[model samples]
Target chain A: MNAKDVPHQGSFRSSLYLFIILMIIWLVLTNSLKTEELLSGLIISLLLTHFLSANYRELGLPRLRLKRAANFIAYVFVLLSEIIKANFDVAYRVLHPKMPIRPGIIIIKTSLKQDIAKVILANSITLTPGTFTLDIKDDALLIHWINVKSEEEGEAAKRISERFEKYLKVVFE
Target chain B: MKKGVSIILLLILLWGVVAALSEMPFGKAKLEVAGHYTDYGKEDTGAANIVTSVVLGYRGFDTLGEVTVLFLACIGLAVVLSTLKKQGCGARQTPSLILNTGFRFLFPLILLFGTYVFMHGHLSPGGGFQGGAVIASGFVLMYLSVPKIKRLNHFVSTLFESVGGLIFLVIGLIGLKLGSQYFLNNFLPNGEFNTLLSAGIIPVIYIAIGFKVGSELSKIIDVLLEESE
Candidate 1:
């Protein structure tokens, strides 16, 4: 069953997560470590968590491990590098005299089974300058390419999503 | 035991609020504003609004930390929510022409209003947080009405958010070291009071916050809406 269909059974773990998150936010927004702020923040967060815990079932908290954390960090670096490279590539295209470019919509397939992984894959694709994810249907992503290098689905997928998908698979799954 | 803790906490909170409220001059004939303002001498920070003075001038260090916290909150939310990132799984909604047209026109206007708000922050009630929220709302409208602008570039969003925050921090550090020993006070000349150009560090600081908060909130909104697809 999908996450949304899950019953409103708020677990201790989810409640704790929500409470901690709220307390942290309260501290930050108040910008105070005073007893007053702490007491108020504690009470407010507890109250909010009590009320909102039912919906926590839909939040779908992930299980974390060291290796996965490291992989996720690595994925961030790779994404940053790609984004920077894409920026320059885009600048070059815009500044070029001829403005030579071919744009087209192409369908690309993904190996990611998890829904979260696929969404990140699509967003990462969008963040990289040359592509935009138009839609995601099943394991397929409809991407609008600024410069369509290949019409073939596999080639497009390799060029656009392969890099991010590699780390996302390990980190999320 | 739980009830006891809850009662104690509520009492403490009530005491705090009551203490603050007791100081207010609700129905005084000769208000402190009438007498003290004349002594306060030309809007100490040259800001017309006392709230602006407090927000971006007097307690700017707090504001800086607040903006940083807001940014971090966005990042945290994104990370947690991204774990559950299921988008385009559900059916899509097609936006009507009126909604599309409204987004096209209203988005820009909202942005303009936000800019105006933060710019006039020193003189008026609105400031960085309000302006930034206004700008983020524009992006929310864009997502809802215009289907073509699929997702905000997270790279761009982070860049703007960080750079904006960095400027605020750098300015504060410089003020702390070089200028008067106040948190974010600087030696810059305070321009004429009740004018757009007034409030030396305030307008600049608020504009930075506007950018930081606007982009940060937009990123948060984007992450949540990513699932809506």
Candidate 2:
């Protein structure tokens, strides 16, 4: 989805999609199938969907196919493992008497266009021990790395964002 | 000199806190009122959470006063901020793709969580005030992440706030009309324990409180954010 593709007003199809999603959330939240709960949920969901659909038109929620959704779930596990690995790496660096650490900020560009995907990539990088997102400017992110492995921007971006961005592109785009 | 005074003040406060802490016994229920509430709260209010029963059922008038205080604070903030000269659009950078996407994804989930908290007030640890704060935090996140997004309509939020307060008042009046005599009395049937529909008017009042508090706090955030802009 691009800026141009964003609807000025909510379309009927999008509104219906929002309604269904909200209704499912309401059902899960209430955790009940009683008539009153269902009735209230229906009314609330409809009202909320109507209001939010208009406001959220610019958001351009991705259309998720089952396979993509599964891929996204798999991506979460991968991100988790990476986080664990990063934790161990940080612990090792901290514990070592030599304290093998060379910290510096590096500018990296992300190819991921979707705000959500870019955020996920940035957060993933930050969560992993070596790197932290300091500031975001357009397509570039200034990241503080505990051990600056590479100085070259492209090489650094590839190393930091490539793993997550590849999957995020599939999930979001 | 200021630093020295602050340090001395901090030490004095710390000493006072320690002295107060040393007098209280640990791991013991001391308050007779607390015991009374715990033992009889569920039976009295039909709420599984005794704290919720006390806040919304027993001392509901106090909660109303607290809500009024919050409302006043928000009103005061709006009044103060409204007088400020509007700043020209500052050189705000467009947020990265990641922040925008992440906020949108989390927004609905946060809303759902907040609604769940307030809805289950009678049955669980959470309640209207907590849920409303959570919802307001979600709005704060929206402001931080997506600065250019259309603002929440003031008219709609004001309507919601007023309607919520009016509902709470109407419910209290109904309690009075039903011959309970006290405001916010449990007039409706206190259904079976632990059910969503149980707890008489507690849940209804809590929901009203939730909407009112949520809108009021969100408006406060809006005012503050706009002032900064």
> Which candidate ranks first by DockQ, i.e. highest?
2
Candidate No. with top TM-score: 2
My TM-score estimates for the predictions, one after another, are 0.50, 0.84
Model 2 scores a C-alpha lDDT of 0.82
Candidate 1 residues lying further than 4 Å off, grouped into runs, are A1-173, B1-43, B85-88
**Model 1 over residues B1-229: C-alpha lDDT tens digits?**
9999999999999999999999987876656655554445345788888777766776677887798799889879887877784545565676543344345334544665576577668777898889899999988887886565447787888898989998898888778787577658755778877766777888888888898889988888887777666
Lowest-lDDT window of 10 residues in candidate 1 chain B? B96-105
Query: Which ten residues in a row are the worst by lDDT in model 2 chain A?
Result: A1-10
Kindly report which residue pairs in candidate 2 clash with one another.
Answer: A115-B97, A115-B101, A116-B101, A116-B102, A118-B98, A119-B98
lDDT of each: 0.75, 0.82
The CAPRI category of model 1 is incorrect
Model 2 Cα lDDT, one tens digit per residue, A17-97: 667877888888788898877887787777777666653455555775887788799889989998998899999999999
Q: What is residue A16's positional error in candidate 2, in angstroms?
A: 6.5
lDDT for each residue of candidate 2 in B1-229, tens digit (9 for 90 to 100) = 9999999999999999999999989999758988889999989999999999999888999988888888898889988877778879786877655566666666765776787789889998998898898888888888887786688788988998888888888998898889769778889899988988999999998888888888899999898888777
Worst 10 residues of 2 chain B by lDDT: B96-105
For model 2, what is the error of residue A117's alpha carbon versus the real structure, in angstroms, after optimal superposition?
2.7
